[model samples]
Target: MTTSKAFIQPLDRVAIALMLLISLLIGLIIWQGDAVKPRVRTFTWENQQIGSEDVSFTLTFSRPMDTKSVEDNLKIEPPLAGKISWAGRRMVYTLLTPAPYGTNYKVQLQGAKDKFASQESSNRLVQPFTGAFRTRDRAIIYIGVNPEEKGRLILYNLTQEQKKVLTPKDLVVMDFEPFPNGEKILFSARTTNDQDLLSAQLYTVTTGIASQADQEPESPGRVDLVLDNKTYQNLKFDLSPDGETIVIQRGNKSNPGDFGLWVMPTSTESGEKPTAKPLKSQPGGDFMITPDSKAVAVAQGAGAAILPIEGDATKPLDFLPQFGLVQAFSKDGSQAAMVKFNTDYTRDLFLVTNQGTQKPLLKTTGSILNCQFDPSSPTLYCLLTQLVSKEQYIEQPYVVAIDLKTAQQKPLLVLPIAQRNVHMNLSPDGLGLLFDQVVAQEVNAPLSGNTLKTDDGEAIATSDLWLMPLLPIADTTTADIKPEKLPLNGFDPYWLP
Candidate 1:
C-alpha cells in the first residue's frame, strides 16, 4: 500500500470521485422509474348526461397507458350485464333495461395496476339523463263552402275522428265572415229574396235569432251590382272593415277595354237587389277599401286615386302619379301599395299615402307578379317572378318581404322551379301565409314487348294549398299545417275576416 501511495497523484483521485458520482445517478434513475406516482392532469367526460341506451368512457394517462392492463382491470356497474361490448381501448356499458324518464346513474372505474405493480386509485362519476319523447296530437282544419243551392251556407270542421257541420238553416247565409271574437261567425244571407228586381227586401243575419224586430232591419244586405250593364266587366271586390260596403271593379268583359269603380251596400232584402253607384271611371283595374271604411283606393289609368266616402261630389281624388294598380292598403289606411310598369314591361312596387304622396317600396330587376300588405303589421309581402323570355314561358317564383318603415327587402321563400302559376295570399293575422302551387307531372307509356316508349302524355295539373308561418323568414323552415290538393281545381284564395 505504501509503495502505491507514493505513485498516486491528486488528479487521479479527482477522476475517481467523478466516476463514482455518475454511477450513483444512474442507479437512482433506475430505482425511481416504476415507483414514481402518476398525476392526473384532468378528468374529462364524454357527456355529463347519458341516455339509457349505451354509455362509454375513456381515461387518459399522463404517459402511454398499458392497453392490456386497462382492459383486464376496468369494471363498470350496474355491470355491463351482457349488454355491453368493448370497443378496443374504450369500455362500453349498456343497460339491459331502459332507464325511467328521468334517472340518475353512477359509473365506477376500478384502479388499474401497471407492470411494475403501481396501482391507480378508483374514480366515481354520476350522470343524469332523460328518456325519449312521446307523440303529439293531430291538427284540425276548418272548411267553409257556399253550397250551389241558393241561400245555403255550410261550415264543416274536419278533425281526425269526426266532421261537425254547422248550418244556420233559419238564416240564409250569403257569405261567411269570421267574427272578431272568433267564437261565432258573421254572415250575410238573403233573409228574404223578393222576386222583384228592385224591391227593398230586407236581408239580415241573426245577431240573435230574430229575438227583437228593429235589430233585423237596421243593417240589411243590399249590395249594388255596379256593372249590371251588359258591357261592364267584373274585376275584383273588397269588403269594408265594418262589412257594410264593398268596392268593386266594373268593366266591359267583351271589350276588355272599358272599366269603372262602383260602391255597393253588400246586402239586399228578400227579393230586393241592391243597386250599384259609380264611384270613379277611366278603365278601373284593382280596388282596395281602407280599414277605416271612410275611403276607397282605386287603381285607374296611370296612378292610384283615393276617394273620400264623404267628400266633394264633383272632383275625384288627385292622382298619385307614377303609381299604378293599387293592390293593397296598410292596416291603418295610412299607406297604399301599388305597382307600376315601364316601356320594357318591368314592374316595380310603390307606396303612397291618401294625400297623394308616393315613394318606392321595392325596386326589382324583374317583374312583380303580385303584392299585398300584412293586415296585422307594417310589413309588405310580395310575389316576384322574373320576366319569362320569349323562348321560355315558365319561370320560377320567389316571395319577398319589405319592411315599410325600414325599407329593407329580404327573400322569404323560393319555390321549386317545377311549380308554375303560383299565387300567394296572407292570412288575416299576418302570421300565416297561404299560397297556391301548381305542379305538373309527365306521364310515360309502356310500349309492346319489353321495350319502353317514352312520349309526352297528358300533363297532370294540380293546385296545392300550402300554409306557413310568417316569422322566421330567413330560416324558411316550417311545419306544413296541411298541404291539401284542391277539392276542385281552384285559385285566387282569400281569407274571410
Candidate 2:
C-alpha cells in the first residue's frame, strides 16, 4: 500500500508542474498583447488668449492621434488646470474657472502612451508655454468719398487716443504727402470756380494744434508752385525724404500736355519764395524722389531716367520695350520699381536697380489698384481686384509681401468682401496698416449719384476706417495674434512717430 501511494504522489507532482508551465505561457502572451509602441513629435499650441481670466490653447499633432489613449495619458495643469475637449481630433484644454487678467499662465503637455503591444513606451515629457498680453487701448478710423476724391489723407496717434482732420476745408484734397517726420502734411487743394485752378499747400500739425504753414499770418503759402494751369491738371507730386523739397510734374494749361519734372524747395523765409526748375521734360510721364533725398527717378514719354535733384541734365537709366510708370524709389536710391500697364489697363510691379537692371516683383494676374512699399522691409503691399463670375467687379483686396531677394510674393491677409475706393497706408514702424473699406449696397442711384443712395434711390454715403496690425512673419503660426481694427476715418492716413 505504501509503494502504491508513493507512485501516485510522484505522478501528481508531474501533472501540477505541466499545468504551471501552461499558465506561465498564457501570462506571457497577455503581457505582450497589452504592450504599447510609443513615438514623439514636436507640436505647437496655439490660440492662447492673453489678458484673460483663464487661458486656453489647442495642441495640434503632426498626425491624427488615438482619442482614447490621448485623453487617458495627457495631463495639463491653473494657469492651466482645466478639462480637455476634442476638437476634430485635436486636443483642446481650457481652465474651468476664469483666471486673473494680465496674469502669466503656463501650459505643459506630458508624453502620451499608446495601446499597441510589443512596443516599448517612451519617457515622460513636458513642454512649457506662456500666455500673457496687455489690454489694447487703440481705435481704427475708416473714411470714404466719391471716386474723384481719391487723394484723401488721414493722421492719427500712436496709441490711437487722439485724432485730427486735415482734409481741405472746402476744396478737394488732392495728392497728399506726409512729411518725413510725420508731423506735417502737404496736399494740393483745387478751386474750380470756372476752370480747374489748383494750389499746393503744406499744413503742419504739432501738439494737437493744426495750422497751414504757407497760409500763416506772417507767411503766405506758394500759389505759383506749379504756375501753369494746364500743367497742373495732369501733374502729380511727392515729397523728398528730408521733407525739404517737392518734386512735381509741370506744364502750361494752354498746352495741357505732359510738362516735365521739377524740384522746389519746401521751406523758405516769410517773404522769400522758392522757384521750381525743370529737371526733365518729356510727354507721358511720372517721377518719384528716392528715399535718400539725393536723386529723382523719372519716366518720361518712352524713356526712363535718373537725375540729381539739382542737375540740369538727366541720364537715361533704362529703356522699356513698352512704356511704364515709375511708381517708387528704394530707400537708399539703389532701386526703382515700376508698373506696366497692359492692353487691358491692368498694372504689374517691377523693380529697376540703379544700374538699369529690371526685375518683376508682382505678376499681372488681376487689376492692381494700388501698391505701397513697407518702410522697414523690402516688400511691397498691394491692393488687388478681380471680376467675379456674376459679371460684377469684385475688389478682393490683400496685403502681399514681395521678397525682393527671392522674387517671391505671398499674400498675408484677405478682405472678407469687396471694398471700393480702398487705400492702404502703412505705419512708419511697419507694425500697423490703415486702409479704407467701403461696403456698397445696391441702393437706388441718387439723382445726383454723388452720395450714397437708399433703397428708394435717395443718396446716402457711408464708409468706415479699418486698422490692422502688421503681424511679424516669424510669428505667423500663433493663432492668438489677431489684428486690431481702429475706429476712426479721414482721407490720407499718416501715423505720427
Candidate 3:
C-alpha cells in the first residue's frame, strides 16, 4: 500500500521487447535446428534479353546447395543441353550451343535440397523457383532493291515482320556494316547529286531498334557523319567485332597515291567528334579486324600479318609468311580459315589455330569469296566460285558447309555461273544462311548518282534475296533443307548480329 507506482521508460520497454524476441528466436532455432528452407536468391539472366554471345547464366542460392541434387532437379523449358558447375552457393550453366534467336526460355528449380538438409526432413528442399529470359529478334539489314527505297539502308525484323528504312533518298548507301548491337549501321554513302562513288564518306545511321532490354529504341534515320571525304577519300571500311574501332582504307584527296589504313573510334567522348588517325604501318590489302578486336589481319607482301592496332602497329604481332590472306576467324579467335596461294595459282584453305596448328582443310581452284564459322557448331560455311566452264572460263559461285573435325564438305547452294556478284552471309544463330543473286543492267549512261551497282561494279537491274535453313550438325538429312525466297527485294543482305 505504501510502494510508489513502478514506471517503465519508452527506451527500457523497447529493450525488454527486443530481448524477448531474441529469446523466442533462440528457442525456435533450438527446436527446429537446420530446418530452414533454401531458395534461389538471384538469377543473372532473369527477365533479361540476351544474344548469341551470352553462353552462360548463373543462379545464386540463399544457402549452399547440394551440387548433384540441384543439377538433377534443374529444368530448362525448350530443353537446352548444357554443363553445370558450382562455386559456393552459386551455380552456373554453360550452354553447349548458342540459344536460338527470337525465342523465350524458362528455367525452373525445385526438389533440390540444401547442403545441410537432412534426408529425414520433409520440407528441407529448395523453394520452387522460376525464371525467364528472351533472345533478340531476328533481323536483316540490306540496301533496298525497290525503286522507291533504293540505295537506302533498310532494316527488316524477320521475327516481327516489321520494316524500316534507315537512310534518306538523297544519300545513296554504297556499303554498310552493322554495329555489334544492331542499333546502328556504319556505312559509306554519297549524295544523290554526287556521281563519284569514291566521294562517299563514313557515317552511322540509327536503326530505330533497341539493342538491350533497358535501352529505348532510337529514332530511325538519325544520321551522323564519322569521317568526311573533304581531306581523305574513304574507300572500304571494316568494323571491329567488339564495335569499338573502325579501320577504313583512305586515300588523301590531294595526293591520290597516298593511301593506307586509318584507325578511328566508332564513338567519342561527348561534344568531341571521332577523328581518324594513320595506323603507322605499311599499306596492305583485304584487311579485317581480328575476332579479339585487338589486331588487324592484313594481306602483306607475301604473307598475312596480324598487326596490333592497340600499340606499335608497325611491328607485326604474328606473321604467317605462308598464308596470303586471312579469310575468316572463328568467333573465339582461336582458329582461322586462311588462304594460302599456291605456285600453280590454286588457293589452299587452311585451318590455322592460335595453338600453332595449321591444317589444310581444302584446296580451291576458284576464289574464296567469304567464309564464316558456325557459332554453335564446329562447322565453317564458305562462299566460293568454281571454274565450271574451262572454255568460257565461267566462275560459278556456290556455298558449302565444312565440318571442322572430319573435313567433310556439304554443298549447300550452287548459284548461277553468271551470278559472280552474289553476296552471302551467315546468321548469328547458325540456323540460316542469306545470299542474293543479282541481275546486272547495262548502264549506257556514265556512272552517276543513285545508280546502284553490285559490289563487283555491275549496274544492278534487280536482285533476289534467298534464305537457306540450316540443319543441326547431328542431322543426317541436311540435303532436304531448301532455300526459301524471302519477300524482300534487296541485295548485299546481311544478318543483324
lDDT of 1 by residue, 260-345 (tens): 66777755766466667766445556666777887776666677676765555235555665777777777667777788877676
Residue-pair clashes per candidate: 21, 30, 0
Every candidate's lDDT? 0.49, 0.52, 0.89
* 1-497: candidate 3 lDDT, tens digit per residue: 68798899999999999999999999998887766579999999998888888899999998888888999999999888899988999999999988899999999998998787666454478999999998999999998868888899999999999999889899998889999988889999999898787899989999887877878898988999888998889999999999999999999989977989999987777857777899988889989999989999999889999999889988999999999999999998999999999998778899999999998888877889999999989999999988777788788889999999988888888888767887889999899999997878876756546888777678887788999999976688898898999998989999998
- TM per prediction: 0.48, 0.56, 0.95
Q: Positional deviation of 284 in candidate 3, in angstroms?
A: 0.8
Question: Which structure among the candidates has the greatest lDDT?
Answer: 3
C-alpha root-mean-square deviation, candidate 1: 25.3
Stretches of model 2 off by over 4 angstroms after superposition? 1-154, 191-234, 268-271, 314-323, 341-348, 355-357, 387-395, 416-420, 439-460, 478-483
| Model 1 TM | 0.48
As for lDDT, the candidate ahead, 1 or 3, is 3
How much does candidate 2 score in TM-score?
0.56
**Top candidate when judged by TM-score against the true structure:** 3
Return the candidate ranking by lDDT, descending.
3, 2, 1
Residue 198, model 1, lDDT: 19
Candidate 3: segments with Cα more than 4 A from true spot: 1-18, 119-122, 443-448
Residue pairs in candidate 3 whose N, alpha carbon or C atoms collide under 3 angstroms: none
